[model samples]
Target: MLRYAATRILFLALGLLVASALIFATLRILPGDVAQMIAGTEGTPAQVERIRSDLGLDRPVAAQYLEWIGGVLTGDLGTSMLTRASVAGELAAKAQVTIPLGALSLVIALAFALPLGVVSAVRHRTRTGTAIGVVSQLLAAVPVVWAGLMFVVLFAVLLGWLPAQGFPRAGWQDPVGAIRALILPAVTIGIVEGAML
Candidate 1:
């Protein structure tokens, strides 16, 4: 058990290293200079060079990668180039919505899937079971983004039942509003996942 756990941890660390390296490499390869973007259209060449130097972008690629990975390992996500905000803080703020949406989606998926799956299994070969199976397959085949758009049209535009977009500025402080905002998204994700199940 100890050996297995250690092996898993080792592999997980290796995977992270490889993923991070690829991400860093990809960003480096992309067109457009980060310093130039930050400096904007009117920035002088001297300003761009200074911005690059300040960001340590003038260093060797390997040194930059090492510094970045080291900071990540130590729980410093570094500052965003555009926003100049803490990357970790930005991620944490987004997680407030993302985590809840995921949980609610799973809950809704399981709630519908479990009972419907059971009925479909028990009534195998019957018309009701066949209909349910067909519907599930159809739902599963629908693209999630398209489903979300259609749902927004039906529930938000036509029925005027929910807000079409954006999270509450107050976040969970406005519990009822938060949940209302999430309901359509959760249901859209849930329908697809439930169909798959």
Candidate 2:
């Protein structure tokens, strides 16, 4: 089991590396100049060129990739393209929503999914087992966004129990409100993920 786990982890790391590489390569190949876009329509050639140089867009793709890889290794995710804000800071702020939602969803999913899975497997020959299996399959087929939207429609739109969009501006400061705000989204992601699990 340990060996299997290690192998899985290694494969997951490999997949992440490949995916990051693909993202970088795709961004490099995209049309139009990012520097020009940033410099804007009224900007002259010299200004655009300056912006490009400042952004290190003048560097070779290989050099840029190496720099990016080094920054990522050192926990420097670079700056936001539009806001000029620290990418890491933005990610950290965003984590308030993602982290709690993910953690809660995982817990909710596991707490319910495990037992359902076990029962379904155990009673495979029984009518109840067949019903459970069908339900699980049906849930697994539903998309995450659809589930989230349904939660919003039911809880936020219809019942007005939770906010439909946007996370708390104060983040986790108000613990009660934060949890309540996240519950719908968490349940949305959790239910779909748990069912798929």
Candidate 3:
């Protein structure tokens, strides 16, 4: 089992590396200059050139990719062009909100979906089971952004039941207040997970 798990891990890592490389190549293949795009149209030629040089965009594609992968290995994702802030830092901050919301939503999804799916499978011909299957399929078809915005409108805007956004830190007087902020986003993600399950 241990060896099997290790082999699976290695294969998954390899697949991810391959997928990343393919995506990088695809982006390069697309029209438009990436450096120029980063520099923006308002930037002068000198500014764009400087930005390209700063990003090592003058290097060959393979060299650039190698440098990028090396930097990623060293936990350097480069800076955000607009904010001039470390992308890794921004990601870490976002992850604080996103990770917990994802975990909670996944728990909610499993809590509902597993038993529901089992019931649907067992009582395949029953009206209630068919309804569950239909609802799941319909939910699976709904766009995530649409569902998120709808929840925001319903819970935060119209009903005034939950706060719309931003999380309270664990050190706050009401540490659990973050979940109130998280409710809509959690349900939005949970709906998709439940449908897929």
Best by lDDT: 1
- List model 1 lDDT by residue over 98-187, tens digit each: 999999999999998999999999999999899999999999999999999999999999999999976899999999999999999999
Task: Please report, in order, the local distance difference test score of every candidate based on alpha carbons.
Answer: 0.95, 0.86, 0.84
Each candidate structure's TM-score, on Cα atoms with residue i matched to residue i, is 0.96, 0.86, 0.75
List ranges where model 1 is wrong by over 4 Å.
Answer: none
Worst lDDT run of 10 residues, candidate 1, spans 161-170
- Give the per-residue lDDT digits (tens) of candidate 2, residues 60-169: 98798888988998989999666789999999888878887889989989986999989999998899899988888898899989888887899899999888766767
Clash totals for all candidate models: 0, 0, 0
* Residues 5-77 of candidate 3: C-alpha lDDT, one tens digit per residue: 9999999999988887888778777898766887778888998888878867677878877777788889899
The candidate with the higher lDDT, 2 or 3, is: 2
